[model samples]
Target: MSKDNFLKGAAILSIAGFLVKILGAVYRIPLANMIGDTGIGYYQTAYPIYTLMFALSTAGIPVAIAKLVSEKNSIGDYRGAQRVFRISFIGLLIGGVLTSSFVFFGAKFIVGKLENTNAYYALIALAPALLFTPIMSAFRGYFQGRQDMTPTAISQVIEQIARVGIGLALVAVLLNLDKGLPMAAGGASFGASAGGFFGSLVIIYIYMKRRKKIRKQIRRSEKFEKEDTSKIIRNILIIAIPITIGASVVPLFGAIDVAIVMRRLQDIGYTQKEASGLYGQLTGMAQTLINFPQVFSVAIGASLVPAISTAFARKNFSEIKKTATSGIRVTLLIGLPAAMGLFILAEPIIKLLYFSNPLEVQESAGSILKVLSFSVIFLTLVQSLTAILQGMGKAFIPVRNLIIGALAKVVIVYVLTGIPGIGVKGAAISTIIAYVIASFLNLRAVRKYAKIRFNLMDIFLKPVLSVAIMSIVVAITYNIFEGFIGLKLATVVSIGFGGISYLFALLLTSTITSKDFELLPGGTKLSNKLKKIGLLRR
Candidate 1:
């Protein structure tokens, strides 16, 4: 893939990811307001079970397809590419049904292990989502494999929109009906099914619209016969199994928090309600807030998956090095400032967004966010690095690293969370620790396999310096304005000011240049304007 096109693809997905996240925040902030901490606990506890199922049925197969298809398309084997998609889609659908059934029929047993029996209704409500999510994800993976990020981006926004609107509407309905928190939480959980169904429709519609064109293209390229179905499935399984195992391990972080945190707290003599509230603070509040900042890394990392696959297929080591290096640099450039800003403004931001929640809950959540904020840098690094490894056909490396991290997290959570003074904050700490370990291992593997040397200046120092400057701006902006506009409005203004200042800081340090912005939509025009004003390199 061309560098410019690759970066542009990442930008498209990044914008879409950010928009989806904003919609999520808009939904969940209000949902939290309506449900309170206990209700949030139920919602979050149930959500992970859905996420686990979604990951299992969807994660490994699409990735395997994406890589396989990219290799086929790179060689002008469009027929082979289409065959891979057909096979993977069928497999994904079957897997989706089985996984969905497991969750639907086994909700009680699953939640029993999670130590959150109140999530039973939520899990039941969410099970249908697994049926469609794998299908939606399969289509997304196929499109991404073709390097057409637009369809996937469009589907993401539409999916999140359906989720937010339907979720809140159901939440309002169930609450108005005087249903208890569990049933009301289940209403909110059903939004995942609505979203997956709608998202699947969007992609299916797009695919149907493009079917004739794909067929026509395929007809023109009868270069080689398609591989046998068994061979294709075998190739797919080789890649998919490791990825599935790895991706499955990822949600286990949440599961670890779910299983360990509440029970550990209770073991230390905390009441069930208190332990549940703490769990909600970590998962419901902080986890939701942290997700928005990750769009940059997530977008670039996802784009890297297929891009790296193509490069690896062509034996283009220089291209792989260039792209992987760029991914890491960009991840850092965005992640550093995001983590610092979140750390600096964690309290006000949490309070501003979750205004309807009790002060105690909000404050407790703010503290959790502060500790978790630093993980932004580490986790984003892990994400980009893992993508690099996956694209280079080393999928199991990340799985091994992540599993090690998760094991460490299990130990940390067991030990730290039971401390009365430490409580749920320990879970946040463990997340960072896990990412630190995983990122280090992934980066080491990338360097060894890809034979790339990273410039600390580009990937680390400049970003750190820029973030240092931006943090001062954010802290001062909030402090100055809080006395006049109140903490909520001050938080808003500080964020606006902080964003602008970070841009200027980046420009002043030559940390980000015209070349980088040129990858974004309207970036060329913005670069021209910035150059004319002397803010960008000529």
Candidate 2:
């Protein structure tokens, strides 16, 4: 891939990613208020199971499809690419059905087996999402393979809008049903499934409209070949199965944590209701706040994968190293300050976002947020590193690292939570330790396979200093405006101010340059524009 082509792909992916993330946060905010922390607890309990199903059905296929299809198309193997797509669709359809079955019929058993039964209905409600998300993913992969993000972007925003509107409506109606909080929580889950169903339909419609012409073009092309359909089916399954298991380890570990913690808490004398409610506060309230800023890194990491895969296919090692390093650096740059800000401001933020609905959840939720804030920086680092290594075709390395981390987390959680004084705090500490270990392991894999060197002076010293300077400015401004402004709105304003200040400080300090940003995969034009507009003062 040429620099220009890579940039174009990155730009499109980043914009779509940002839109999707924004929608994710927007939907969550109102949903959190509607359901309260207890409802959120039930809602969150079902999430890991749903994520596991999503991973099972789609997992690594879209990525593999994106990589394989892009390579074949770039090398003039349109027939092979089309065959892969057809095979992917068939395989995903079967996977989706099986996953949905597990959720639909097994939800009660799964929930009952856990220490909590409050989330059983919510798990059942999310079953249809397991049915459709894989199919939606296949279409997304198809577009990504072609390096066209319009369909994906449009469908993503549309999906989120559907999710938020439908979810809010359901929650509101359920809240009024007098069926109580668990029912309201299940309503949110139902909304998610409804959103997925419609989102898949829309994407499928958009894809069919565009696909007919592509199929006709391929048929007319001299490059087209008549291949055995059976062979294509076998090849796709071979690629997707291992990728599914490998991709799902994180969510699987999460599900395990949910089950284990609930059981353990009950054994230690807490009621199921109390345990599940506490678990909900940890996942829904605390983790949600910390995760909001992480959307930036998640977007960057996700886009980096296909782009790196494409670069690797073209034997563009220079671009590969550059893109991978730029991705990690950017993740750290955005993630670290956000982590610090969250840790310092967790109380106010949680108070603002979750306090009104639950009433009694504010203090505990704030404490959980503080603990979780420490985890996001490491989580973002690990996430980005894994994406880079995986994109470089070093998938097993990340899998191994994740296993090591998961084991470490389990040990930590058992040891800490066993103590009389430490309860939910133990869980949060375990998560932090796990991600830190995972991040280091991922860093090692990147250094080993990608031959990327960490430059301490530039990557750590410069960005940290830039972010620190920005933090001081944010603290001052926040202190001044906090009295008049609510914590939620204050957080937004403070973060916006800090981000702008950090970029300016970086420019003035020569920590980053127009040339540096310009050399990034999809950043040349924007960098030049920034320089011209005096955004990069140095």
Candidate 3:
């Protein structure tokens, strides 16, 4: 794919991922209020297990398939690409079924070991999602490998729309029935399964519609070598396993925290109720806010994989360098401003988002969010660099780095949370340290493998300066508007001003130029308009 095509794919996925993150916030915030923090604790406990299983079952397989297919297609081996997909599809199907069964039948045992028996209902409800998501992922991988991002983007929005609508509706209905927290949380979990089912159907429809064209390509290809099914399967596994392990790192740490956090809190003299509530505040509220900014990184990483893989297959080192540099630059551009915004507006953001919650809950969550905000940049770097490494066929490097980071997190969480006054703040601090270590290690690996020179000024300094300007403007605007309007309206207006200020600062300082805009979807027209308006320099 050309650079324009690569940017277009990233832009499409970024927009879709952003929308999905918004829908996710819509689902989580209301669900938190309806179920309360303790209920959110139960819900979050089950969620980690589901995500870990998801990482193992679906995450790496799609990436592996995408890489394999892209490599084969780059050389005109269309038949070989199809064979990879076929074998991967069957492998994922069998794996998904087994994992789903394990989670469903073993739900009680799993949650029981974590000392949160109430999570069992939610676990069981989430099991069916596993059955469908792998299938959807296979179709998405196939399209993405061909450098087409529309299917993945469209399916994501559909999935999120279904998830929010069905999840909220189910929770509301179940709450009226007074089935208690576990059952209500279970109902919400069932909505996820429902969404996955709908998403799978959408992808299936897309695949069927394009099947004739896909087959035509396969039939038209001549003088191409084909690999046997077993060899294709082996290649898929070789690529998939390390990627799966690296992807699972975060979820594995999350699962560890689910088992450790509340139990340790209770061991430190908090009651079971207090422990669960605090855990909910940390994971449900603080972590949810942290995830909002991660959408951009995830989108960049997803787009980078196929682009870099295809470039690497063709031994196009120049394209690889350009793509890697641009990916890192874009990641820093988005992540720095987001982290600064979250830190500056942590309390107001918490108050606005969780206004329905008690003042104490909001305050507690706000404090945790302040600590978590620092993680945005590091986590974003870790994600982007890991993708670059994966594209370079050094997938195992990230797995090792993340494992080391996770170990540090576990030790730090244990020691700091055990302190008399620290409690959940320790977990937040530990998260930052973990990501910092992981990101630094990943960056080193990227530098070693890709041999790309880092321009510190372009990546960090300019963005930081722009964010500083934006922060000052935002603070002034918010303070002035607070007296005229309420907190919510003031917060909204201030954020709008901050975004605009940041953009103008970047433009004025030449941090963002016409070239950057040209990299975005619809960017050529936008760049022209901006140039006409004196906002962009040619």
Estimate, for each residue in 407-496, the C-alpha lDDT of model 3 and write its tens digit: 999999888887759997888888899989999998998887777777888777887888899999999999999999988899899999
- How much does each candidate deviate from the true structure in C-alpha RMSD? 3.8, 3.6, 3.7
Rank list by lDDT: 1, 3, 2
Q: Give candidate 1's TM-score.
A: 0.86
Off by over 4 Å in 2: 1-10, 64-87, 142-148, 207-215, 218-230, 302-326, 450-453, 476-497, 519-538
Tell me the tens digit of each residue's lDDT in model 2 across 53-104. Answer: 7887788788777766777677677777877887888778888898889889
| Candidate 2 backbone collisions, by pair | 7-522, 41-280
Q: What global local distance difference test value does model 1 have? A: 0.85
lDDT of 3: 0.85
Give per-residue CA lDDT, model 1, range 1-538, as digits (tens).
Answer: 8989987887788788889877876677788888888888888888876777788788888878888888888888888899899989999989989988998999999888777788888899888889988898888888888888898999999999998889889999999999988898898999988998999999999999999988987887759975899999999999888777987987889878877887888888877767777787788888887877676677677778887899999999998887787778778887788888889999998898888888998888999899999998888899899989989889889989999999999999889988888988888999999999999999999999998988888778887888888889899999999999899999999999989988888889888766556334576799899999899974
Candidate 1 residue spans exceeding 4 A from truth:
1-18, 65-89, 138-155, 202-229, 302-326, 390-393, 450-459, 514-525
Query: Model 1: clashing residue pairs?
Result: none
The estimated TM-scores of all candidates read 0.86, 0.87, 0.86
> What are the lDDT scores of the predictions, listed in order?
0.85, 0.78, 0.85
Question: On lDDT, who's better, 1 or 2?
Answer: 1
